[model samples]
Target: MRLDKFLKVSRLIKRRTLAKEVADQGRITINGTVAKASSILKEGDELAIQFGTKVVTVKVESLKETAKKEEANNLYSVVKEERVTAE
Candidate 1:
């Protein structure tokens, strides 16, 4: 699955466009390397997404074309979440 689609399907981001924008801006990383919106996603891949002051890290668990609201959380497992504010 594409990184943007995985983000949306996993509910990490609200929309695909925003995911793409974030990725394009170099706010997302896969395994410590910068990733693009069209980056490929695979099981067990770790994604670190920057959202304003919060950094959300998740490991890809599964991939599907679509998921129900109840099942959305199963797609990825949040490994760590950190909040970094300006000093």
Candidate 2:
């Protein structure tokens, strides 16, 4: 699945366009490298997303074209989530 679609389908970013914009701005990384909206998402891949001062990391668990709200969280597992500490 495309990274943007996966993000939306998994309920990570809430919208595909937002996800694409985030990806285009280099706010999304896959396996520690910057990734684009069209990047392929696969099981076990690590995704790190920067949302303002907060960082969210998740591992892809499954990919689906569509998922119900109740099943959205099952698509990925949160590995790490932290706010950037002020120096």
Write one digit per residue (lDDT tens) for candidate 1, span 1-87: 999998898788889999999999999999999999999999999999988999999999999989988999999899999998888
Clash pairs detected, candidate 2: none
Q: Model 2: how far is 4 from its true place, Å?
A: 0.2
Best by lDDT: 2
**Top candidate when judged by TM-score against the true structure:** 2
- Predicted structure 2: lDDT: 0.96
- Model 1 weakest lDDT span, ten residues long: 5-14
Clashing residue pairs in candidate 1 are none
lDDT of each: 0.93, 0.96
Return the lDDT, model 1, position 21: 97
Residue 11 miss distance in model 2 (angstroms): 0.6
